[model samples]
Target: MGKSSTSVLVILAFFAIYVIWGSTYLLNKVAVQELEPFMLASCRFTTAGILIFILAKIMGIPLSITKKQLWNTIIAGILFLSFGNGVVVWALKYVDSGFAALEISAQPLIILLLMRVLQGKKIQPMSVIGVILGIVGIYLLVSQKQIIAKEESITGMVMIFFCMLSWAYGSLFVAKADLPNNYFVNTGYQMFTAGITLALMSLAFGETWSAPLSWSGGVQLSMVLLIVFGSILAFTSFNYLLKAVSPEKVATSTYVNPIVALLLGWYFLDEQITAQSIIAATILLTGVYFINTKKTLAIFERFKR
Candidate 1:
């Protein structure tokens, strides 16, 4: 593809990650109203996985990964999807989707800390400052009077924190681990493994699928949207962007998603957007910007010197 064509595709991919993934938080909130969290996740991933697998096969993508790669992919899948995503789905029962998005926005900071601790990666001073600011933002968000007024909201926030941690670890692990060169094949296997695991978890938790059959149109539509837009399109776009653009540029989705989620939640679900939320979001996103954009900032500082 020409440079211009690639640029357009990159921009489209950014839209998928920023808007579509952001929308999934609310869609998941709607889905869990009728479908249990694990069950809902299972269905969404299974459907998306199957479709992606078929597409990969048709595209002649190599699927012959080693046994170690398979096992690593499965482990990453469980961490990223079954735990990271499934837990968030369950927590959305108690937390507003907007708040869940805000909490998840701390993921880049968490990933930096994990890399520093687990891999002995040296964090820049500015990044450390960013991490500190992010923590304070989280505290402010969770300690809001409205959030503290409800015990369930506190519990939900705690669960979302764990969810973010799992996602960060999974991201780091997948990046380091050996996997197939083909992004579509890798994603297909991961989603398939996660889907099967979530299905078993749903059965273990005694969740039934009957509720979805009788769900309202809105809830049913949300499920379809989650499977199509959230899983298939957005995930494929993200995988493409990983190759097409700088990781730092792709990481900007973490900053954009929460804002989109918050606005959608307010408009569609009537989720409250208090002054506290605005202040907290500002602080949190500022920290994220610093952390992700550290490389560019360093270059600018050097030029000044």
Candidate 2:
């Protein structure tokens, strides 16, 4: 691909990740009302995993890997897909889509702290301030009675918090861990492993499989959306961006997702955007800027040497 073409693809990929993946939050919220949440996620991922595996096979992309690489990918899949994404899917059953988006926006803040603690990365002064500001924003956003007062919703929030932490750690791990370079292979294994784990969990949890399909059209549509938009398109673009952009730049999508999700929620569901949400979004985006943009510019300046 030419440089311009690559740039355009990157931009498109970012948009897919930002907009499509963001919309999944609300979709999940609506879908869960008609389906078992974990089962819903398992079905989505299983289908996506199968499609990716098929694509990889048809393209003759090497899917075989060393034992070490297999183990690493499996671990990442468990942490990211099963725990991280699974939690969010389950939470949608109890939380509003817009509120869920706000809570999930905390991932970048979690990533900053995890990098400093786990990877021995320096916590820049501005980044520290950003984390603090982001947390305050999340607090304000989630303090609404609609979000916090419901016991099931509160449990969902806690699960989502852990989900963010797991996902943050998984991202850093992917950066540092030895793995295959082919995005298809890496993503294929991750989805397959995650899908299997989630499916098993869903079965163990006694999620009934006897439910009629037509009665759950919304859930079926949500699953299709997740597989096509969320898993296949968004994920592939994101992994491609990882190679083309700085890790920090790729991380910016985390912040961008909530903005997209909030907007989509308002448009489709007529969800109100409150002053608290706007304020929280500003703080969160500002924090993401500090964590990603400042560091990226600093690194580029050093590269000019």
- Residue-by-residue lDDT tens digits, candidate 1, 1-305: 79999889888989999999999988998778777899999988888889888887888876789999899879977987899899899999999999999988878788777867986767787787788888988888888998999999989999999988898787666655677677777777778899999999999999877656788899889988988899888877876665555443465687778898999999998999989888889998888657756585464234223
Model 1: lDDT to the true structure:
0.82
- Assess each prediction's global lDDT (C-alpha) against the native: 0.82, 0.78
After superposition of all CA atoms, the RMSD between model 2 and the true structure is 2.7
Cα misplacement distance, residue 152 of candidate 1 (Å)? 0.9
RMSD from true fold, candidate 1: 3.7
Summed backbone clashes in each candidate are 0, 0
Instruction: Using lDDT, give the best candidate's number.
Output: 1
lDDT of 2 by residue, 137-209 (tens): 8888889766666899888888888888888787777766766688777877888888889989999899965
